[model samples]
Each structure stands twice: as structure tokens, then as C-alpha cells.
Target: MWRWILERLDEQFPAFDVDRWWGIDDPFERMIGSVLVQNTTWSNAAKALAGLRERSWLTPQALGSLSADDLIPAIRSAGFQQAKSRTILRLVHWLMQHGGVGGIIERQATTEQLRSELLSLKGIGEETADTILAYSFNRPTISGDAYARRLYQRVSGESLRYKQIRHAILDEIKTWADLARLHGLIVEHGKVICRKRSPRCEGCQLRPRCLFFDHAKRLS
Candidate 1:
């Protein structure tokens, strides 16, 4: 299935490229950005993250000293400023209490354990946990978002629960690189061609292998 889809994508979009999404190199930056990106565009999240960084409050240690209200303006661009600010400050306190963000990552906890711990935090969810696990720690977790869900439904003709879908996708892909590349590709694809309301499958790279496209063609 993996090879089939990859071949189809390559054939249809010869110049198709998945951008490397590791913009914030530090694990702490990635972790904070991952949480801040919830229900927001990357541009907004980037702006907020940059705001925090500019004030040198991007670190857990710095955030530990700051109150939630004090952090609101820096992350206001990401929306839900107060709620997210509270969440971020709480996370900072937790990290500081545990020795710091570096201490948390340095634990090298198993993926499951780490995800559980993250979810235990106030605002962190499965998507945020998986994002931190995969992007921050280079763990092999299929980060299932709208992009991945839509791509899966289009290509496989299946409605899947989040965990089930992510697990299934991981099973099909060969390596961590494949998972990472596919995640980025589908995200870009979702933003560009494979929209929710009306996907542009006519000239899309995955149309050749997409179940929806094939079904439509057969009906016609």
C-alpha cells in the first residue's frame, strides 16, 4: 500500500516536494510550538512563538517565573490567549518542577509513557503529544490531523477513529522517514489540493490511487 501510494504521488506530481517541518530545532521550541499550534494556522503559531522567543520566555525556566496573565500577549496571536496562556504556564511550572524541559526530554521515556504523561497536562491532547513525540524526539508516531484523516479517507475509503487511523497508517509505512515525509506531504496537500469541502482531485498527485477518484471514474 505504501509503495502504491508513493508511486502514484510521484507519477502525478513529478515536482512534488514535502517541506522539512523542523523549523524550530530545539526540542523545547518544538514542544511549545506544537501546543500553541492547536486550532490555529502555522503562521499565527509562528508569530506567537517568535513573540515568546523575543522576550526570552520560550524556555521552561523563564516561563516558570512568569504568570499566565503575563504570557498572554506574547501568545495572543494563536487565539484563546488566556486559556493557552494558562496551559503554557502550567506546563512550564511542571517542567521546572521536574528539573526543566531538558530534563523531561532527557528521560527518554517510552513513547506510550511519554504520551500518557503529556496528556496528563492541562491542555495537551493526543495530537499535541504525538507532535512532540515525533517532531521533537524523532519518535515514529503518525501525527493524525485533518490532513492525514482526509488523505486516508480519500485514498482508502475508510472512516477511522484517530488512534486506529494513525496506527494503521504507521503499519503501512516502512520507516520513520516515510511517516515524517508522508505527514508533511499530506499536510501540504490538504492545504493546497485535498481540501475538505471540494478537493481538487483532477490534477492531484494522489488521484491515481485515491479511492474517491477511482470510484467517481467508474461511475462516470
Candidate 2:
């Protein structure tokens, strides 16, 4: 079922690309975007990221050196400006303490160890940690965002916890590329088709196997 869903989503959204979705190529930049995008849309996050880049403050050392007040203006577009600024500062400090991005990337820590370290920080959570692990560190882990949860529940007709969903999907994904593509595909499908309100079920390829669609059809 997982493979089927992945294959169908790939066919549906042929141009889906995870790196493009985050609008960053550098692993560190991807980490920054992931944090900035926490409670805002990608468009807003992109603006904040652009602001950082324009000021040459995109690096850990540059950002860590700035006061939160200075960082806030640049990231105002992302909303929650004050809090996000503090979070970013804390993240940069944490990264520096852990031997900076290069050191952490080269460290022998296991995925779980890295995840624990990230979660110990102020704004980092399961999703963010997994995203850093998968995208930044090239680990075979799923980010398990809201889209993945909603789609998985609709398809399976059961609500599962984030860890449960991550484990289930991780079991099937063999490589880093597969993990990245699956996360991108699920998010794209949710935004384009299985949205929160009035999902486009009429011509959706997954309708035949979608429990939510079948139930809605019976009700109608």
C-alpha cells in the first residue's frame, strides 16, 4: 500500500522536488528554512531566508553573533518574529557548541543521538529534527509533517501517532532519496489534492483506495 501510494503520487506530481520545495540547496540553508517555516507558509519563510542571505547572515557564526532584536526585523515576514529570532539564535549557538554544522555532520553520532540533541534545543521538535536528519544529514528518516499524517489516516482509516507513521514509512523506504521524495510527494499531494477543506476527490488517482473518499461517496 505504501509503495502504491508513492508510485501514484510520483505519477501525479512528476515535477515534485524536495530541495526546490524548501527553496534551498545548501544543507545548512535547508536547516535554516526548516526552522523559519515552522509556523508560517513557505512563501513567508522564503522572504525571511532572502533577508538573511541579503545581509550575509545566513551562516551559523554570522547569525549567532547578531542580537535577537537585529534578527527579528529580517525574519518579520515569517511571523512570530521575536520568538523565531530567539529560536534561531539558540539553534546557532547549539550548532556551534556541537562543533558547528561541519563537525556535527562528520560526527559519529547515530540518527537517534542527533535527534535527541536537536530536541533538547528550544524550537526543535520531532518533525524538525527528522527533517534535519534526513535532508541535512542525509539520513533515511521521514519528516512526517501534517500532510503525511492526514493522508496516511485517510488512506488507512486509522489515526496513528507521528512516530508510528514515521516508523511505518521508514520500514519501506530504503534510501535517502526515497525518503526525501516520499516526504515531498505526500506534502504536494496534500496541498494540491487532499487539502484540509474540500479535497479534490473527483479525479484523484487515489480515490479508489482512499477510505475517506469511499466513505464520503457512500454518504453522498
Candidate 3:
């Protein structure tokens, strides 16, 4: 199943890239933006991030200064704005208290170490932590949110939860590069082919091996 995905992605979108779409180079900024992206569309998240950048509030010091109220309006487009704002503000404060970005990474923190720290913040979860680790810190970790979980379940006919699915995929994925590429592929595939309902499987590269597609065809 995994190989099928790689083959399809390579064929259909030869130039498909990952890090570029996220538009976040800084590990710290990616961490913050990952939280902002929760349950929200990328465009809305980008808007909120743009607002943050406009105010020079993308860093710990600047963001830490915002009250929940002040921060909420800027991210209002990104659903659950007030709650997300609080989470962002609290996370910034915690990062600062812990000696900031250099302190966290320079310590050679384990994946679990960073995950625990991020999870301690209000809104950060396993998915968000893995995203921060992979997209930001360059950890060879798998990020499984709604899109990821749904796609894998549909393709593999697996009942694995995010944690289980994450471990399963990582175990099978041989290289750090593959992990990174697959993460982005799954994200893009979910958006374009494996949508929540009425997914466009016929046009999908993975249609040859996708379980959902096979099952639906068999029924028909």
C-alpha cells in the first residue's frame, strides 16, 4: 500500500514538494503555526500567521506579550480563535521560560521530550507534536491528524488510531527522506483524493491499490 502511494505520487506530481507549502522555515514558527492550523484550513491559518508576522508577533517575546483577547482577534479566521490564541500565548511563554529554541534543541531532546513539552501546552497534541518534530525540528516522525488517519484507514483497511498508525508507518518507512516525503504526500492526498466523503478515487494514483476503491467497486 505504501509503495503504491509513492509510485503514484512520483508519477502524477513529479515536482511535488513538502516544506515549501507550509511556508515556515523556522522550527519554532512551524511549531506555533502547527497549533494554529488545528481544525482549520491552511488559508485561514496562513491569514492568521500573516497577521502575526505583520505585528512582528511570530516570536516568543512578541507573542508572549499578547493577552488572550488581543491575540484572539488576529486568529479569528482560524476557528476556535480564543482558545487557539490562549494556547499560542501560553506556549510562547513556556518556550521563553525554558530558554527558548536553542535551549530546547541544543539539549538533544528526544522526540518524547519535545512532545511532552509541547503537549504540556494547552492545545498541542500528538498530531501537533509530531508535526512540530517532523516539519520543524527535522525529526523522522509521522504526523497523523484527521487527514492522515482518514487516508490511511481508507487505503489500508486498518483500524489503527493515530499513534498506532504513526508507529506502523514509521516502522515500514526506511529512510528519513521517505518519512518526510510521505508525510506531505499523505496530507496532499487526503485533501485531493481521500476526502471525508465521496473521495475522488478514480483519478487517484493509489486507486490501483486503495482498499476503499476496491471495496466500493466490488460492491457496485
Candidate 1: where is the Cα deviation over 4 Å? Answer: 6-19, 97-102
Residue-by-residue lDDT tens digits, candidate 3, 27-116: 778877888889977788888888888989888888887798988888887889988988888778878887887776666777777778
> Candidate 3: which stretches are off by over 4 Å?
1-4
> Which pairs in model 1 have colliding backbones?
none
Give the better candidate number (2 or 3) by lDDT.
2
Of the two candidates 1 and 2, the one with more favorable TM-score, higher being better, is 2
Per-model TM against the reference: 0.86, 0.93, 0.88
Global lDDT of each model? Answer: 0.77, 0.87, 0.79
How many residue pairs clash in all the candidates, one count each? 0, 0, 0
Kindly give the stretch of ten consecutive residues in candidate 2 with the minimal lDDT sum: 16-25
Q: State residue 177's C-alpha deviation in candidate 2, in Å.
A: 1.2
Candidate 2 lDDT over 21-117, as tens digits, reads: 7667898888888888888898999999999999999999899889999999999999989988888888889889988878888999888898898
lDDT string for model 1 (33-97, tens) is 88788999888999999999899987777888888889898999999888888878766676677
Comparing 1 and 3 on lDDT, the stronger one = 3
